[model samples]
Target: MNRIEFMTELAALLQDVPVEERREAMQYYNDYFDDAGDENEEQVISELGSPAKVAATIKADLGSQAGDYAEYSENGYTDSRFDQKEMPAGRAYQRKEEKEPPKTSRALKIVLIIAIILVGAPVLIPLGVGITLAVLGCVIALFCAFIALVVASVAVAIVGIVVFGVGIATLIPELAVGLALVGTGLILTVLGVIATVASVKLCLVVFPGICRGIVWICRRPFQGKAVA
Candidate 1:
């Protein structure tokens, strides 16, 4: 119904109620009617049902002591005699409106706590493997380097020993010094390979976890709200 029609029906219904409650209910509804436009008012009134139905419900709810003398239709509605009849207003009508929250809203929360152990373990555990592989590579490389140094040292030592043997047979000290230099170079080269392999493995293992975290963060907004 239009605003005017709705007001007319409300006025009719409130006639039997006490004055204060009647006015309050009427005023509240009037304010509501003004706040909403034609489309909304129509929708609200439609939901509330016809004028007679609305009036009847309000009268009953207000606790009007309707008796057998009260006019009702075959289906217990006010019949023709109730039309335009004025009853008292200005009584208390306890109107309590309860508005329920939307059923589909989701609460803000922490969903998953990614276990750091699960992620870091895979990256760290393989460091041992990488270290072993690098060490093996370095050992092989250093062993070859060491062998070259040793052979070169030995050849020089023998030549020195022969040269000294020609000069008085006293070049043993020079041979010993050359062999010691060859051994030291082998140890340092092995360490470098071990460090290199570990670095490669750490970089590779952590990459996939970072990528997964990025994708999950991006999709958070689009996730559907929980229906409760």
Candidate 2:
């Protein structure tokens, strides 16, 4: 949607927010869209995703920032402290505590870890093992195919050489058959070599991508923040 529609939707969603805070958020986004210019309006909307998402993110951020305010009434003296806007929604926020290692009771942590392991062991372990085995199976199959192609290529070339040699060593009667065998072996050798080369190239291209995909999948669970 255009900037006007986007802003209107955002304002509607933020109606429950404090008037001043809502105005501040609207103004912030308005200025952002203004700076982006008409040419970049679509790009901005796409980048920000839906207005509803931005509003929700803002409320979530506000709630987390106002966690301490939970104990106090809305009219408390500390209300102004929570009135301050958090960092904008589209970017990552890192608290100082999040940067440092968290402290936890050793026994509790152990118990929690064990509990998670036990709960997920039946599913996660098998899924992980299955994925690994599948990948390994693919690699092994490719490797074996490559080996077979290379060996076949070498065997065909050897046959061609031997047949050609025999043709040259012998006289007229066996010469034609020997020459035909040599030709057939040479064609087989060429086809085998092509197959081997193609297989090697495919393995080289495909396995690295598979490895990177697996690494990305593995890292997602550990990452605390995700792009909206």
Candidate 3:
């Protein structure tokens, strides 16, 4: 049969189903044919089989889902054969469509949130401020500590250089003391150079990571608020 003949028969057969379900099923099939196009109409029709078969499948599915209930026609013909295995694939019949939340529920939720904000403003505001201040304080303290480490390393290196210079000046005056001083200076200078390099490398890794973490933390509250 052609699409028109098949769909017409299907609609008549589904008269016992609820109006909404019937309409959805008809719309689904109508859209299916349109999507298949005129060239593939015969193939689509053959795959779907007869309209009576389709209607039976729909009734069986709906009956099973409706739970031990019977659907009757105007002539009092009742259909009670509800086998779950008889359910149709790729059909809108008996499908559970997602429904949006009602306007009243949405409005109530918004009102409840506003009420909570208003009631808790005094305590919440101060608590939020304190938490923000604590975070900022910790970050600042950590940054200062790192800076101090870098500065201390540089300072040690400078001190080692100065001692080395003094040792060179004293070499001619006191050979033994000068040799000891020079050795001490060399060790100190090497230690200072290692410390400086380690401190700089650590800062390079830590600074960017800390900055990114701060940015993420700062954006979190705003992102949640915006989504709500």
Candidate 4:
């Protein structure tokens, strides 16, 4: 359907909603359409789906907020911190209350935290230390393994060169023995080259990726603290 027809239907469906909320929702969609330009009018309408669907979502959100407000009022706390704003289609309206916790509640939380710390300090401290040590040990082990692989690869290449020289010296004495040594040296050298390439790739790509993953995991808990 076209924008005007769609909006008309949406308005009719939202008649039961509060006046201010309805107006805000309407204005938000109107502005959205203006911003999108006439070229994308059909695309926007398609993305919004049916007007009845949009109205139902808004009504459901309002119902949930009403329930929350009712519960808040029943608790003998009154807040005049209501806020309404226009949003995108799926979230056409938002109502938020920016109320701080009561002083008593905040004090209670602090007391509870202190109590927990006092009771659990012995176990928590050791547990945290053990976890940290385990992670460090794993990282060290991986690094040592990488170093060992690189060293082994280089050692094999060096040994192959020495064996190849010995084979050349032995060639004059025994052709069969010299040929066998030469073949063995070539195989070892090829294997060493392959291992070295693999180690280089691990160092340049895989190891850094693993480190980044660990860092991301460590930061996850602190990332959204402001929102909390």
Give each model's whole-structure lDDT.
0.53, 0.67, 0.76, 0.73
TM-score of each: 0.26, 0.39, 0.55, 0.52
Error of 4 at 56 (Å): 40
Candidate 2 per-residue lDDT, tens place, 1-228, comes to 788899999999999988866776776677566656667778778777788887876676468675643222232212332233442223322323436667788999899999999999999988989998987798689778757766776666566566656655553667677677667656765765676677667768876887788788778877745642
Locate the minimum summed-lDDT window of 10 residues in model 2: 70-79
Off by more than 4 A, model 3: 1-104, 225-228
- Show how many residue pairs clash in every candidate, following the order shown: 9, 0, 0, 0
Name the 10 consecutive residues with the lowest summed lDDT in model 3. Answer: 75-84
Index of the highest-TM-score prediction: 3
Off by over 4 Å in 4: 1-104
- In candidate 2, how many Å is residue 213 off? 3.1
- Is candidate 3 or 4 superior in lDDT? 3
Best by lDDT: 3
Better of 1 and 3 by TM-score: 3
RMSD of 4: 18.7
Candidate 2 Cα misplacement greater than 4 A, ranges: 1-118, 121-123, 171-173, 223-228
Cα-based lDDT at residue 195, candidate 1: 41
Whose TM-score is higher: candidate 3's or candidate 4's?
Answer: 3
Superposition TM-score, candidate 2 onto the true structure = 0.39
